[model samples]
Structures are given as structure tokens and as C-alpha cells.
Target: MKTWKIIVLAAIVVVIDQITKFIVVSTMQIQQQIVVIPNFFSLFFIRNTGAAFSLFEGAQWFFYLTTVIALCLFVYFIKEIGDLNIWTGIGLGMAVGGMFGNFIDRLLFGSVVDFFKFVFGGYNFAIFNVADIGLTVGIGLVVIGLIVSEMKKKKTVAE
Candidate 1:
């Protein structure tokens, strides 16, 4: 992947994530959630009280620590990404974008605006935002890439 392509992808993710959050924050009142889908899905807007699944709720300082660590990881990954691997480029781009998106939210509002909710049976997951989706999707891509690479390695070694 070209360096310019990586830059463009990062910018796109940042714009989309910020715009979506802007809409959510500006339109919806805090703690006042509206369910877009019933049962298995919904949009319940809330300033996340904790990390994913409401972990570490009372520790506001953890947000800063986590964001800094995430930013460092993104920088390291971006610098180390292989030039020809578009998948790696895209994956790192999404991760960086998501990291920054939530970072900005944390800086400005001290919390992220989470609206998407998924549930099944008696188990209920915490509400998440678009940034989390980007991050998760990027992680999925990376895992898939690693699996495919390993398979190819095994095949080559066996040949």
C-alpha cells in the first residue's frame, strides 16, 4: 500500500467516526436512550461509565492511560506495517482512527458516546460506539490475516 493511501484511509475513518459521534451527542440527551431495534439490537446512547462492558467505572484516570497506550500501539504498528500488505495498512488505519476517535471523545467529554447494543438470552453486552466497531473490525482483519499467513506457511513447509 502507498503511504498516501494509508493517510487517506486514516482520514476517512476519523471523519466518519467523529461525524457519527457528533450526531449522536448533539441530537440525543445523555442517558436518554432510544431503541432503534428491539430484543437483539438497539441504540442506547450513554456516556460510557467504564471500559468495554463497564469495567473500571470509577477510574477516570484509566481512560487517559488506556488512550495513551492505544496511541502508542497504533504508532508502532503504523511504522512497522509492511509496504505491500494492503490488509495490514487498512487494519492499522482503522485501529489508529478508532483510537483517536475515542481519545478525542474522552478529551472533550470525558467519556465515549455509546449507542449500539447487542443482546442474547440472559446475557447482555455493553453499549458501544462506531470507534469500537472500527477497532474491532480492524482486529478481526488482523486475526484473519494471521490465520491465513499461518496456513500458507504450513502448506509451504509441507510441500
Candidate 2:
């Protein structure tokens, strides 16, 4: 993947994430619920001051530090790789974009705006946002890429 393409992909994720958040914030009140599918999913407005599932609530400085470190590591990893495959590039782009999306929220509002909610088997799942989706999918893609790369290397060695 080219550097420009990676940047463009990341920018697109950030833009979509921000736009969705803006729409939610502008139209919904805190704790508001808009059901899109009964007994399955809904948009539930809430601000999370911590990590996933609201863990370590209110540790803003810690989050800021960790985010910076992670981003730096990402840059280093990409550079070390020299050339990224499509999956790796797209994965990194989405991951970075998602991180920045939440980081921006933390900087501007002291919390991340989460609204997407899911329920399964009568248990409520963690409420998350677009950024979370990007991060999760991105990481999954990266993992798949790594596995495929390793498999290819092993096959070559055997041959």
C-alpha cells in the first residue's frame, strides 16, 4: 500500500467517525435511547471517561499517555516493515484513525461519546462508537495479515 492511500484511508475513517459523533451529540441528550431494532440494538447516548467498557474511569492523563505511546509504536512498526501489504496498511490506517477519533473526544470533552448498544440473550453488551468498530476490525485484519504472511513464509521454507 502506498503512503498516500494509507493516509487517505485513515482520513476517511476519522471523518466518518467524527460526523457520526457530531450527529449523535447534536440530536440526542445524554442517556437518550433511540431504538433501531427492538430487543437487539439501539443508539444510547453516553459519555465514557475510561477505556473499553468504562474501565479505569476518569484516568484521563493515563489514557493520553498510552495513546501517544501506541501511536509512536505504530509509526515505528510501519517504518520497520518498509513495505506494507494491503491488509496491514488498511488495518493500520483504521486503527490510527480510530485512536485519533477517541483522542480528539478526550481532548475536547474529557470523554468519548458512545452510543451504539447491543443486547444478546438478555445481556446488555458494551456501548461503543464508530471509532471502536474501526479499531476492532482493523486489528482483526492485521492479525489475519500476519497469520497469512507467516503461513506463506512457512510454505516457502518447506519448499
Per-residue alpha-carbon lDDT of candidate 1 for residues 1-159, written as tens digits (9 for 90 to 100): 665676677677878989988898888887776766677887677887577988888576887898798778766765675452656667767766777787788788878888887888767887888788878887777667667667878999999
Relative to the true structure, how large is the alpha-carbon lDDT of every model? Answer: 0.76, 0.90
**RMSD of each candidate relative to the true structure:** 2.4, 0.9
Candidate 1 TM-score, C-alpha based: 0.83
> Worst ten-residue run, lDDT, model 1?
77-86
Relative to the unseen true structure, what is the C-alpha lDDT of residue 104 in candidate 1, on a scale of 0 to 100? 82
* Among all candidates shown, the one with the greatest lDDT: 2
Candidate 2 residue lDDT tens string, 48-70:
99988899899999989998998
Q: How close to the true structure is residue 91 of candidate 1, measured as C-alpha lDDT?
A: 72
Q: How much is the lDDT of residue 134 in candidate 1?
A: 77
